[model samples]
Target: MTSDEEAFRRMVRGSEAAFAELFDRHSGAVYRYSWGLAESRDEVADIVQETFLVLWRRRKEIRLAGHSVLPWLLVCCRNTAYNHNRARRRSPAGELTEPKPGTHAWHRRVEQEQAVEELAWVREEIAALPDTERRLCDLCLIEGLSYDEAASALGISPSAARKRIQRARGKLRAAKTANL
Candidate 1:
């Protein structure tokens, strides 16, 4: 192994100085990777911090693996960014423009009200779905399973899983069009 790889292994085993060396050697590459995805400095910084935090938490497993760290780090960054985006989407402020300091509080309140109403409508629509379709959606989409995986989990065949997902999607699209 190269000296840098050896140092990274040490760092993952909790060597503070080795961790510093690892950071110095790779933080620029990580930051650039985050910047490419997030575009916002704050979000990029969050992704970097999350990536390292996860690395530290999983250090033991990391030390056992003989693969290059860069690809693992990149995947970690991407996962972190995706998770952050999903969380931000769930926030009330996510859909609205950043409020100016001088903007009226009432205007912000109105925006929040509209967002809540939209969320309620979405919830109702989802709740209105047939139980089978709803369950399929929960397994395949929310749980992030492939059709084959979802089928195994749901005790169905892969073709059945695919058909269920397609039917569910069609139902949702029809509901959306009807609502519009």
Candidate 2:
């Protein structure tokens, strides 16, 4: 195998140095994917870490078919961000979710105000969900877990998780349209 491929294999074998090298190689691409999903730097950081964590956990299954690991990492980053967004929406007190801009503090407070207002609306909508449906949203959308992962987390089957998410989404859609 090529040197890069060899490195990938080493990474899969759970070498911390190998993992660090892999992280250095793919972090930029993963960050870009995360940024595309949400402008928040904090969110991007979380997604990157989560993606790498999953990769580390499933290293044996990962194959270095190409010279790059960008594609796999990007997919993981997207899913991670999706899960993060979903989880934020399920908070009980209906907290506002904003991507922490981190170093991008140049924007005016007016922009912050606008984002806060939008977040409030989102929180209210989520708060309107019934308990079961809200939990479904939490497991399915937040925490970046797959249907299986979410199901496992909630102690339900994957099929049940899928069904509950569908039903909850339908209610959310109906309620949203009612407001229009």
Candidate 3:
């Protein structure tokens, strides 16, 4: 059997067969991971497709971790799931059928609305942060980048990235408490 690293190298060199081999080997694991993060089967399928699309588009830039491409693919899957969920949260809520008053469904709907309102308030707080801190939150908190990755992207030290993210969280927590 060809190793993942060798297959990935061939894929990067523009071999469609190698790319297919990698996809065939890892797509199941990616799909399973997507299911854990996504809410519905359709969403899971979308996430899996986006993950592989990302892998193909960024093939030249990706490096196998620990001699396997699965880790990178899984990370891409997670990031895709997060992006999907975040976009769904930010979009206007669809027309909800009103459940009978005093029923469990009605109560659940009310709770979901309250949660959405809280998420909006939190987004506002993040938006109010200093420019650098806001970027830090978007990268490290929202997009799930590691401190080192965020730091490199932001042209700062990892320690500074960590501190900024911590400070941003503290401010957000304080703001929430004050509002309550």
- Candidates' C-alpha lDDT: 0.74, 0.72, 0.86
Cα lDDT of model 2 by residue, 1-180, tens digit? 235566677677655555766777778888778888854555777888889999889889887567777677877788889888777667534565655555355345558887988677765776678776666665455434578887786788889888988877787778668867
lDDT of each residue in 118-167, candidate 1, tens digit only: 87776566667877666666566555568898788778889987887787
Instruction: Assess every candidate by TM-score.
Output: 0.47, 0.47, 0.51
Regions of candidate 1 where Cα sits further than 4 Å from its true position = 63-67, 92-180
Pairs that collide, model 3: none
Predicted structure with the largest lDDT when compared to the true one: 3
* lDDT of candidate model 3 versus the reference: 0.86
Candidate 3: residue 37 lDDT (0-100): 98
lDDT of 3 at 98: 66
- After TM-score superposition, the amount by which residue 47's alpha carbon in candidate 2 deviates from its true location, in angstroms, is 0.9
In terms of lDDT, model 1 sits at 0.74
